[model samples]
Target chain A: MTNPIVLDVNNLAVSFQTFEGDVKAVRGVSFQLKKGETLAIVGESGSGKSVSTKAINRLLPVKNTLIESGEILFEGKDLLQLSEKDMQKVRGNDIAMIFQDPMTSLNPTMKVGKQIAEPLIAHIGLSKEKAKARAIELMDLVGIRNPNEAYKRYPHQFSGGMRQRVMIAIALACEPKILIADEPTTALDVTIQAQILDLMNKLKKELDTSIIFITHDLGVVAQMADRVAVMYAGQIVEVGTADEIFYNPMHPYTWGLLASMPTLEVGKKQLYTIPGSPPNLLHPVKGDAFAPRNDYALGIDFVEEPDLFQVTETHYAKTWLLHPDAPSVIPPEEVRRRKEKYQTVRMGKACGERIGGGAIGSGG
Target chain B: MKKYIAKRLLTAIPVLLMISIAAFIMINLAPGDPTNLYVMPDATPEQMEATRRALGLDQSYPVQYMRWLTRALRGDLGISYSTRYPVLPILVSRIGPTVALMGTTLLVSYIIAIPLGIISARKQGTWVDTLLTGGAFIGVSIPNFFLGLGLIYIFAVQLKWFPTGGMLELGGNASILSVLHHLVLPVAVLSTFYIANMTRYVRSTMIDVYGENYIRTATAKGLTKQVILTRHGIRNALIPIITIIGTDLPRLVGGAIVTEQIFQWPGLGRLTILAINQREYPMLMAITLLSAVVVLLVNLLVDMMYAVVDPRIKYD
Candidate 1:
């Protein structure tokens, strides 16, 4: 049986009031997080991945941002119906969010220890001494050396990776049920990115915390995500388990995203990039937002929005190409080859596991 | 920190010396000798020459500056040419009223500005914000001399609520309460620009601080609005506000020149103007040097305050 749902967001829409007009940032987006699962929402910039997660925590600015519609149900209760006082209790206690830029996210004037201890004091109701002790412990947990000494230092003293580590430590302080990491490793270099991802993976197992990971990097999604959601223009165009999304992506937007990522494996000479910028949100689209960009666009795709079409019990894709009457079109050869390669690697690993076990048994 | 402060103090010595040299040269270059104001027009040429000799006015500029510099180095600013009294004593007596007026105005302006700025920023795009913005614009635009006179007309002449001008009535009781009573109009007049400046600065800074990513981080930490604002918002915004206040310190003393002249308040500003009017070379030089010193000291203090407020800013 699958893990139980911890947080469920349904048909959530968010709009930002700018001087020009009301920009509908997120529209009719729905998703659910399971306990201890890492659900990575992968999309390009301006795809509303970050905005969707920010809306979950009510972190959006109240002055100019308006929650247009929809229910954010955490546990059984609707989070949207809760008061600010009640939201505060749920925010750092039940859910915590880590931001993209570690440099800008941490307060420069405050000690890293105090910053880490903030959530503990606010949500866990820990005394200063106890919170500080826990903060140091968290620092050590995130692999910061001499965490006790490092705790007293300001944010500038730490390197970029170390600062990101501190950010993770702060988020993990309260041991919340859900952790929302919004492009957490995007600002770091490749090596540091791997280290942070590894640390987060370890923490997920240790804490059994569900993570909603938002990223534009498909490579990061491959490593860290259990489930993947491909968002395009404020909507999830495809949702499935990691294997299904990678090995058998159905939506044209998902194909564009995957086609764009560089791989060591042989592919086309030039990188495939989606043509045209995202549509301006000042004026909402009438039909499929990606219809203009899709190379395999059906005539009906431009006039009507397609709902999620079920491919498997756990996989779904929103595209007109999935219709029964639509002409058959094969995935690009490079994507097919990559899928085959992934299958071969997995089969080889399984085969090796059994042979190694048998060889050990015979030797014994 | 001690080393930083010591180094700053060391640097100030040369700065003050340069200021003294500049002030001495500028005052001496100006026309209208102090002897002209002191002597009678009908006095004999011999009498005028004798008076000039006694005052050392006939000496070379270098010779006179060197003499004054030597006395100043020994903590004496020399005797005033216009009054013939010791310059230090006259300055010592006059500085108190200026300090009280400026200090109270500074305190009141900050006390009023900080809250209004915060509230204005919080209530941005609201009627309250618009009203405060309108008020700040008006406060910044009004000429202090005109405002002082207008206040005198309304409160002193029309309503008879306050004394028109001066720190105190001649021969009035020298109690602190009575001094404050006399201070009402002048303080209000002096504070207008400060309030206007500080409130606008603080409002912009607070709004900018509110947009900082750390504020979102603070909010994500489940902090109350009050805690987030005080701990994150105001703390960071305070850096720029302190800067504005610090750079405004020299102006605080200098801007008082016009206001002091209009009210005839017995302060260094009025004294400086009087020295200029009467060609009190020694007194003018002394006041200019003192103003420069105040500016340098305030800059040092502001730098120290930066290290205190921002942990990332180390004095090393």
Candidate 2:
């Protein structure tokens, strides 16, 4: 039997108060995160993926950010209804967040071990001695060498990869059930990014923690996610298992994302880019947000937003092409060939064959 | 760090020497002579010339500077024209009262302004913030001398709650209560600018620190608003403030001069004014050089503080 859902976000809508008007940053976004699952929320900047995740933790600025409508249900309790005092108990203890930019994420004035030990002492009421031991243990667990010596060192003393590892150790200190990483490796170099991602995946498996990974990088999403949710403007346009989203993506926006990613297989000099910018959320578009930028946009796509159309039990896409009366459309040829390549790689992995890292690099 | 401090102190030697020369030249070049303050108007020209020659003021600027520099290097700052006591001894005796008064003022200003600034930043845009910010503007705008007179009028004149001025009563011994009694007005006057400046600084720096990513991380770690503030907010905001306070130490000497004059406080500032007015060349030179040395030492101390507050800053 499939693992039960651990978090259910229903019809979430969020807006930010601005001088111009209220910007509808996240509108009618809904998703489920299963226990021990890695769900990657992929989108370009300002797509509201990060906003939606922050809304779950109520981390948005109290002054201008408003949740117009939403219910973030975690373990049968509506987190939105909980008081900030109660939310404090849930945060770091039940759900911890790893932010982008590790350089700025760790306190410059504080020692790294004390930073990691902070949550432990706060949530578990651990004694200072115990917390220190636990902090050192966490540092070791996150792959930092010589935990005893490094514990007293400040963030600036460590390399980028080591600093990110420190961030992960801090997040995992209280042993939360859910980990939310918001583009955790986007600021690191390519090699460091791979190492960080690998470390996170290993930790996730060992801890059995449900992770909601937010990133704009398809390469990261391809390597780290069990399920993928493609966000456009302020809405989720497509969500399915990683294989289904990679092999049989139905939404035109998802097709664009897949096409735009630079892959080794695509030897052509010209790289594909999405034609136009995301819709301005201040005016609140009447139809689908991606319609203006979509080349395969149908007549009705300009006038109305489509509901999620389920192709399989787990795969759902919101697109006009999924309508019964709409003409059939196909993804670009590049997507089709890449999908075939991923399939072969997957089959080889399933057969326990070491096909090497070249296939995985091309898949990205 | 020690090497950096050594280098700083080494550079200060030339700066102090130049200040001593400038102080000597400016006083000598000015229309006043030290003999005028001491010699009687009815004294004969022979007596005036004898006094000038004895004091070595009749010498050229270079010869006077060399004599003063030699005496200073030997720790003998010559006799004060007004007091007829050794300038070094007089300055040494005055240091205690000035340090105590200014030290208390700075301590009180920091104690009050830090919390007020933090509250202003945390409650930014609220009435509390508005009120505190308004107070800071007024504090910064008001002249210290005017503020000193106003405070004396209210507390000393109207309330009769404290002594009017000076370090202690004329005949009273150095008791804590009497010192505190005298301290109230001068400290209040001296600290007004520091409080205003420090509060505004703390508010601005705290606001900037509140937006930092580490603050968010601290919040996400389930830290209460208070913990997040003390652990992350204040520590980061304190860096720039260290620079402010560190640099402000040298400025305190200038402030003390004005404050000391108004209160009749027996401190270096009052002595400085007395020396300038009386044209006590040796005393004035000593005070100027002493101030320059203090400025260099305090700045070096501040740089060291920067390294302490932020481990990322390495002097090496």
Candidate 3:
């Protein structure tokens, strides 16, 4: 049986009003999260992945942001319709967001322990003594050893990995149903990144909390997401299970993003590349924003924006090539080979689970 | 670091020596000698010469400069002309009022500016921020004397709350309350510009610091706004404020001059002016040197405060 939806974002479009012009940031984006699933939104900078998530919490400056039409339903309430004060209450209570730079997300002057207890006091109405004990427990839960001492320390005293762990602790302090982690590990080194990801995976399992992971790293999405949404030029172009996005992406932009991934091949040192830069949002496009750079674009593809067309039972792609009457094509064989590797990871995760209830499922 | 201090001290000595020489010349260059101002016009030239000789004004410029410099090196700043008493005693008697006024102004300005600046910066681009910016504009545009007179009109004349001038009621003696009452107009006059300047500095510093990565993290981590303001923004903002306070030492002293005159507070500024008007070279020189030295000492203090405020900064 499917878990109930915890958060639903429908047809959300965000625009920035500036002296230069209106910069259309996020457009017609929609997605949902099951009660405890990790839904990864992958896209490059300026793709509105960050903006899309910030809108849910009302974190952006109201003067510049115009959320033209959207319904951000979280546990049945329209988050977008709430006042900032009301939203701030909801934030860190029911829906918490962890930013990219872990160090930047935590206040420098406050003790780590106190910062963790803030949301609990504000939202949970916990007393100081009880909250302090719980804060230390959280610090220990997030893999921080010597939790009692760690709580007394400031943000500066913690390492990057430790700081991110602190951020995770604070995010979980209120036990929010949804945790929006925006590139939580992008600022960390590879080894620390792995640790943070592992910690997050463990926490999600333990807490049974859903997470909306915003990142441009396809590799991270492959490893973390149960479902994936590939955003480009402020639109959700193609979205599906990790297998479909990696093995059988229907849009040219997704193909480019996959092709652009740095392979681990030794010494051959070939650099994969996308042909052109992202389309400028200042004066975006009348038709397909990606058409100008897409090599296989046809006459119709250049003039009309493709509606979201069904590709599979759980897959959708917003590209003209996905149209029923259009000519069909497949990704390169190498891309297919990468999909086989991804399938193996899923298989590995499933087999590991056979050992016991404690085993991780096919989420790797 | 020692080399830097040595260089500053070395550069300072020549500037001070030149000032001493200039003071000596201006004091002697008057058409009628200072002694003549004291003696009757019918007195013999011999009597005037005796007076000049007794006061050591009959000596050559080099001899006079040497005498004063030697005496200054020995910790004596010569006698006052108007009072016929030692300049140090006169300065000591009057230093209380000027210092009190300046000290009060400095305290008030900081107390006012810090919160105002933080508030202004926090709501930048909003009406509150615009209002503060506009207020600072008025503060910067107004002359200190005008503001002083304006305060005099409102508090002294119209409301009759504070005295318009003087350090105290004439026979009130130097009690703390009387001193403060007398200090009102002068300190406010001196601090108006300082508070305005400090607010602008504080606002800009806070704005920059508010955007710091750590502040964002702190807010996200759920610290209270007050905690973030004091611990995150205020501590960092104070570094620049300390530096500005250090550099503005001269202005802080110069500002007291006009206020002193207006209030008849009988401070160093008053002493300097009286010496200048009466051709008292020694007293003028002592007051100028004393102001410079106070400023120099404040620079040392500021360097120390920098380290206190920011651990990253160290003065070797």
* lDDT by residue (tens digit), candidate 3, B1-316: 5665676677777877776677667666755567867778898989989888988989888898899999999989998866789888887777776667777888899899888888999899999999998898788778877788888899999999998888767786878888788787788787778888888998999988887766665455444577668777787677777888887665555446666776677677776677777877788778777777677667766776776666555456
Distance (Å) between predicted and true CA of B129, model 2?
1.0
Tens-digit lDDT track of model 2 for A144-215 = 999999999999999988999999999999888999999999999999998899899999999999999999
DockQ-derived CAPRI band for the predicted complex in model 3: acceptable
Better of 1 and 2 by DockQ: 1
lDDT of 2 at A156: 94
TM-scores for every predicted model: 0.95, 0.94, 0.84
TM-score of chain A of each: 0.93, 0.94, 0.92
Query: Model 3, residue B34: displacement in angstroms?
Result: 7.1
CA displacement after TM-score superposition, residue B245 of candidate 2 (Å): 1.8
lDDT for each candidate structure: 0.86, 0.88, 0.79
The deviation in Å at residue B304 for candidate 1 is 1.0
Residues A264-304 of candidate 1: C-alpha lDDT, one tens digit per residue? 55345887788988888888786898888788888888889
Worst 10 residues of 1 chain B by lDDT: B247-256
